[model samples]
Target: MRVISLQPSGDLTLSTDAVKPSPRPNHILVRVRAFAVNRQDLKIGPSVKDAGVECVGSVEDAGGVKGLRVGATVAVLSFGEGGLWKDYCLVPAKCVIPLQVSPATPGSPLDPATWAKLAAIPLTFLTAFGILDNLDLRKHDRLLIRGGTSSIGLTIASVAKALGAVVATTTRDPTKAPNLSENGADFVILEREGGIKDDVRMMFASKETFTSTDELSTPALSTTRINDSAGADKCVDLLGVNTVQDSLLALKGPGGICCLAGSLGGSGSTSFNPIKDIPSGVYLTTFAVDRVDMGKVPLQEIVDRVLERGEYRLNLDRIFGLEDLDKVKDYVEGNKARGKVVVVLPNEL
Candidate 1:
């Protein structure tokens, strides 16, 4: 079996002589068909054996798990564990999500195009769903997604739109505006170095008029003064701590929720003071995949929405074979991908 080996010097190499893994009790051995190359893979330490985290594969051995049979199509998630960058992956049954067998390709793996699209779903879509659930998003709400070009960001935009929210997204490059719009972003804002709060305010202007208070005359103007100009009803900040404060300031009013979902802008600490930085009546929260409950995530429904019903678009940017691992890193880390980048294993493997 061949697998991506991580060297101590923080480099990766394809090792062809590796032995395939066997499933333990309550575990299933999966034959990986395709895997998504994620930005989080870059941060993985060398101590981890493999170099990928999410994959779409077939069950080789179901380990007697209820309702799981051999050759069932499934999505495997290996977050905070051994990765799935090889011919076979050994994961606990709980980590395996059984997908609906494709009617066109029943009892067999999906076509290359379909497998690649399915590979893009597990991690990004699940994380996006968790973030939106935490924010308590409602239909017709004005939702803003900072760093919208990311895979998870794009997924959020599509899913939110399906749920009837008016989605607004931010991108650093103006050329990517069309891509965002095609994936269900009703409005796209160009993100500047500081933030997009001003841009979001302009797009989602408050209907109610308020008199601007004189700074010196008020002696102690409440943070509500900022809310007077706030616009977005909710925000999912994928840019991390650096832009979360800015996203918070763009809320339409008090009680607006802002969820910090990604660290695409770098996870460095920010000088955030709750009383001084967080707007009055605005709530700031964080969504960590490992900490969130996955039971609430409608995995089958999400798959149906993207693949079956066409309610959502899986923004699959590019597909690479196993041999093009180097190019995969370059495409994702260089921020060249506007959405998911997938790596498909050859049938011979």
Candidate 2:
């Protein structure tokens, strides 16, 4: 079997003479089809043997797991345990979510293109779903997303739109504004080093409907003035500690909830005093994928929404081959990929 190994000097090496792994009692053997590259993969230590985290594959052996049969196509959401870079992986049953692919040929593997698209969904979409769940999102709610061009951020925006929320998002690059708008963001704000509080407030003020004073009930058509509390009712902050305070400033006070989800801007330490930092009656929370329970996550529904129903777009930036591991690392580390990056493994292996 072949696996990508992480060297101590921060390099990825393709090793072909590796022994194949077998599944334990609650695990299933999966033939790797494609795997998605994430920023989290870059932070793994040298002690870890195989490097990939999320992938889509065929169930080679069911390993006595109920509802899992041989030849079933499944998405592997291995947060950190399963070595998904290899040709075959032994993933725990709990981490595996079965997917239904309507193929032209029965029981055949999806084309590499479909595999690449599906591979982009698991980690990013699941993370967005978990964050939205934490936010207790409601229909017609005003939702704001920071780091709008990120894969997870895009997913959050699309899902929030599907749930009937009015979406607004931020991006550092002005060129990426159209992409954000196309992906369900009703308003796209160009982020600045100073902050986006004034821009968001200005947007709200300029677009007020003047029909009512209840801005919280209808932010899209609120009559609230710019000087008033014109801000997003719910916010998903992906920029992490660096911009959390700014996010708080942009949020509607007294009842708004801000969920700090991703660390795209780098998770540096920051001094904090909740009494001074958080506004009165507003809530602050954090979401980590490691704390998510697979049984509770609606992975199957998310896949259906993105792939089957066409409710969400698959934010696939680029697809690479197993041998192009270095290029994958460069694309992600350079912060060039606008969305998810995936690597498709050849079946001949």
RMSD of each: 5.0, 5.5
Pairs that clash in candidate 1: 255-281
Question: Candidate 2 on 1-349: residue-level lDDT in tens?
Answer: 9898776666778989988887777788999899998887777574746687889989999999999999899988887674688899997788888988766466665888888888999889889989999999999888889999999998899889989998999988988898888888999988887999887766654233335646467666655433244778889999998888888877776678899988888879878567899877778999999888888877778787877889988889999997788888889988898889999998787
TM-score of each model, paired residue for residue: 0.90, 0.90
Off by over 4 Å in 1: 8-10, 44-48, 103-109, 207-229
For model 2, the superposed segments whose C-alpha errors exceed 4 Å read: 44-48, 104-107, 206-228
Each model's lDDT comes to 0.84, 0.84
For this target, which candidate reaches the highest lDDT against the unseen true structure? 2
Error of 1 at 196 (Å): 2.3
lDDT of 2: 0.84
Candidate 1 clashes: the total is 1
